[model samples]
Target chain A: MKAVPAASTVEVDGEYRLKREGTSLQWNIADESALEAALRLKDGDGIVTVLTMGPAKLEAALKELLARGADRAVLITDRRMAGADTRATAAALKAAAEKTGPFDLILCGRRAIDGETGQVPGELAAALDILCVSNVERLEKTETGMRLFRRTENGVQELEAAGPLVVSMCEYAYHLRLPGILSMRRAKSKTVEILTADDLELKTGECGLKGSLTKVITMEAKYPGLRKGPKETDLSKATEQIQAMLREVRP
Target chain B: MKEILVLCPHGVDGGLLSKAYALSEGNLRVLVLEGEEQTAEGYGAKYIHTIKTTPPDEAAFAGWLAEKIQSWGSTIVLAPATIAMRNIMPMLAWKLNAGLTADCTALDMAGEDLLQTRPAFGNSLMASIRSLSTIQMATVRPGTFRPVEQKANEPEIIPESGPAETGKVRELSFTEFAGGKPLSQADVIIAGGMGVGSKEGFEKLAKLASHLGAGLAASRSAVDAGYAPFRCQVGVTGVTVCPRLYIAVGISGAVQHLAGMSGSEKVIAINSDPKAPIFGYADYGYVGDWETIIDRLLHLEEETL
Candidate 1:
């Protein structure tokens, strides 16, 4: 799923603050990497469907994913779904998956750029009752099962997983192929199926901001006074420290 | 009398136990696997349960653990917010229908309710969360709390039965990624971001990294823009580095990106945007054109040659 934060809401001075009201109507690059990875795994077979749950205006983002080679697209939009937290959002997306698939595999971007929670994959994996691989760089097929090269804190570890698993791709793990004119034309012609709370049977009271586990209490801008680090303006001194620090670490 | 249980199969960080102790008022138990019994004992946990289980069947563990939590009537479950814990805890949370906060930076007891503070929207916003379900669960971040010192008195060690559903999934073989030095171990790092412009732009930073014998890193935008490899990316979604010196070029700092590298001993940043968040974190700030600043650095190197 692609999410854009309202850039205009950002207020930067000596401090960092943002109002997440405006949203960009485009694909999140991390999710786009996952989409591209899904295509690579497709390997001239299997269908790739892109789904996003948001307001009615998010259809365009789904269409863009379609142009990039998704076989089908789903726009699961409902007012009741608004302001859903990570758990609720994962539940809604998982429920949408149920409606669209008895799918053998599910792929997601590492984390949403907006939320930066990195929670949905595990939550969704739990929701679907499947093995969730959080950090995969590459994927391969085996005779009995599939193999994935997963990134760990130290290095990448290869793991064997079967279908009916959810995997989230690391950022820039795979480069997305540009949509050709033919695929773009087909995407333009296709009618994106829309699913509502009625279609998914989502309980209104069970979702939205009210259903969320957390709440933002207040906001403030960061300030110069807040920072205690001594700022150096001398390039020569900075360069010397860099060299000394390098020697210290390498030695 | 242990109502709070902390699962530390992957050993334990001081922050995890310190938070656990603070919330439970020094009355919490730690759980580890059989071989890790001594390691958990060193952490000064009053009661440590070392389960004799070894299968990596997370499903079985989740089920067994969830059942155990219900039976014990444990109100709070804490795990290291590392990727390893993340893999299994959410599954457990799902099974228990519990509310869980990921990467919780703060955990406090407010009249029996756990007050959890976590970063949201790429650290652009902070959200205080509480679990509404039967059990409140949270994954605490590392380096936030100090490690409990090992005491002379030994902790009580309880041997636990392995999950019955184990051995369902077996490990066949293994191959670790054969690659260059990872960002986490690098002494000096040169990180890039969207301000680097394109592939051509990133190469300049890479050249400097090579010259300085430093590892290369990128903010989320650079990786998303295809200017750098995913392995070299550094941010909330990428690897964290504790490099002695971190030089961020054309990188606007985002909280997500800062989460990964804010621990660097010293930082120097060059970005065109005067108000770029990178400057706030940097020890040395250069608010100017990245291209021009980079060219000058390269020219100085050439002159020294």
Candidate 2:
């Protein structure tokens, strides 16, 4: 039983890159343990395509994916798609995914550090009209479908979902791989196809501000320079003050 | 003249009404839309419209509210920055062609413009944004305003009648957790976090809270670690508490947690980490082991009583 390349990288050019040294391809950005687990389930025949949406600034993130073992990379970028909110961003990404054709599975970080709304992957799942398994920690390839272990409030729960599903990686999902010098150099020379709005034929309104449903009406300073005087910290006096404050509430 | 409509979710809790009334002085006339049960009189408001809707059909309720706003001839609208208000605000704002700012901690009358303040970028940065459109909107966080108190019973409560639309989502079932004494309502709150070490540690904290009659709260990490239920969590994803005396026990004080409870009247942090962010916001911070400190506090409470 050959181990699969359980790690694939999505590049800025919207291509999936997998390491040639590995057989099975893993599709998560975080959690190397989960990636190794994913490799164990593969027969070493799957192709890993790195997919990403953004300008060339995301090239580094994509190259890192390649170093981790993605077979190829795909970059989806367009000037018209700047300043997109989550809904429009999901729409554009879904369009790019449709253009690149199909896949047995799609994976994404549960949420981006920027705009911690955690709405993109859910919105993307809705846009693509697929089954979404959020916060998946492990994946096991099965004969008919895939088995996944997801984090829940109480504990980890297992679920079986058919292929062609989207899984959002949680905080503890998988550890991100470190890109070796050799893999980093090789990723630089790798071919990454950059797809624009024209390539996806996305409507102008559906790509950026026009397609976004939410808008920021106003922004204001929350905390200015601290105005409160320094606190008195005599332990006995502070305890008395706290007790006095508590009494005022009940009374 | 450009007008902004504000939906007072709690219908001017006297505390909030006075603040809105103060902010609406001069050319700004705050048209407060509230529930029919809420009294609108004595707030010095130019106009008051009360909405009629029950819980469980808020989407339809929002559509109805949007329709009323559409006919009200207002360019911008605002809502109280409460959890219930936020649930329907975005959809209503979207329908009204207006933008919305959630959890605005501060708002000001900037000449002809309205400046809103909110914590952004993981609460590390504060952003002050001014909307270009005439019909800009935002939801102000509660307690952000200092409500002016005055004795005047009769302001006005106008009852509104309209055809409610069908809603997209249906309420299947709901469970209401007994929230104990809400931190906002409590004068003293004893909050625990993951740094407490174990469930036994949390029990000790609870014993201290019991002795002091303070409400028990937990940080997100504590809740995530199963030390406490989600309802007891205090952070951005949980409840915003403004207790008079907040006793933070063994909490590392992540920014998200700080954003929710920083407005407390006074914060006393008990954590071993001298460099913990909680210390920065604490009125008094004890840099020592929580176990020993909690045990001592409990003993002192018993002996003093």
Candidate 3:
């Protein structure tokens, strides 16, 4: 999850730079919602550990999660793991999770704003050999097991599953809560366990671009289309502009 | 001729069928799940292997397809990008020790090699992927390619009838929301974003949408804020629409949100932030508060009506 100053964000170029040099990371809104979903389900039980795979710079991001009620944080950062596609990325994360587990449920954002693949959770679930439920809007504790309300293209689907499952939360469920002074204090003193590929027993060939199935060969700017005149701020003029256009296009 | 296996769960997947036809040099065996053989053939499926089962579970369905592909000697595997299939394709690929590229928007052949290109990084980049394994697998992006009718070409239909092997996952209860026009087919849509302010703000959007005979949608921000429902959220995580007219209200147009609905013929964006990225993509932009602009638009629409 990589969030940055909205105004400074630029399009990814051949250099594959996500953000400008001076830009810093913040909370990815969707993943924040996911953390909230996980915290609600954990509910005063179980250690809700936040796991992420990125550079050492993302250590601050993991610490930010701690302030949001994540009990512990683990960051897997290795030069060998750079440019790993979804499958290989999951392979490394799977190694990290195994170290953090025997867990009940593994939760993630429905889709990362950057990748937008919405594939890692399923691939990771397959790696962990567990049931993967995605787009979960709401989850409540039931006597037998947990009940999940999954948001789909049509509507919502209700599902019941036992523990040791992987789930991705729908952004519509709940936004992440703000960190109070006490939580912020806790986060300051906490240390994020930074692990390398060697620690995870991941080989260089199996963790990065060398192991990934996909490769980004080209990145071109999208073609610009019909541009109406400069933005009109005057209410009366804007309304007239819209009305005139509507009239011209009226069937 | 090469034997290619295409997983067609829906009525017919035009993209996969067309790609399979070209790849196989006219040899295609469509492994369908509760599909019509006649319809599959119309998409140029020379052979349709229907997997008959009760609401086929993905795990079981993938297992069955893997077996069929192995025995049938089809080296190329194609699946349409669906939620279930997205999960299944990776598992199948892993099981077979193969390479898979999901949501491929383009496919081509280079000598004996198959090339697949899919969008990556919020539609900012295109990934050209190929598999080194014996079996090449790809999940085709839905609705990217047009369906060509091959009425005269009849398929050899092999219906594998009976209940499929049970898997760990079971069918769950599905509930459709209070009906609204499906975004996929909506001709006109009025969508709001984080800047829309609140749930009440969305009510304003809905009113304008109703007046214009358009569907109502929202960005992930509005949906997360409880201003709109998840089903109404238009983005990577929700619906991909190409509505004729897409009116974006208070949207900053994050690349994540724009990727879904950028295909609109006409886009009108209303936002107070004059420097907003959305202005770059919209055909028309009104730099003002959405409430103010929407109010005027609503009044104008009412007067016209």
lDDT of each: 0.72, 0.60, 0.73
Real A-B contacts recovered, model 3: 0.36
Ranking by DockQ: 1, 3, 2
Q: What is the DockQ of each candidate?
A: 0.33, 0.11, 0.33
CA shift of B109, model 3, Å: 2.4
Listed in order, each prediction's TM-score against the native is 0.80, 0.63, 0.80
Question: Model 1: clashing residue pairs?
Answer: A6-A22, A15-A222
Cα lDDT of model 2 by residue, B1-305, tens digit: 33445676444544455655656561123334455333445544556666454433344456677787777776556766554455456456545555455666677776666677766533434666566444666777665565564444444456676435433222333333343454555668899998897788788877887777777899988977888765567765456677777888889877567766877877878777777778878877766676766666688789978
Residue-level lDDT of model 3, residues A1-251, one tens digit each, is 43433422645544444444665556555667778887777866668888888778888778878898888999888998888877887788899999877787788876665556667777777788776777778887777666888765556778776656777776546778778688889889899998899999888889888878766655544423335537777777877777675555444
Model 2 steric clash total: 48
**Tens-digit per-residue lDDT, B27-130, candidate 1:** 77788877776656565577777776545556667778888778767778999877667767877888888878887767788777787887654444567777
**Residue-wise C-alpha lDDT for candidate 3, range B167-253, written one tens digit per residue:** 444446888865465575566788999899999999998998777767799998888788997778787656667676788998998
The reply for model 3, stretches above 4 Å from the true place, is A1-8, A11-20, A43-45, A180-189, A223-251, B1-3, B22-25, B53-57, B161-167, B185-215, B219-227, B235-239, B244-257, B265-305
Question: Which pairs of residues collide in candidate 3?
Answer: none
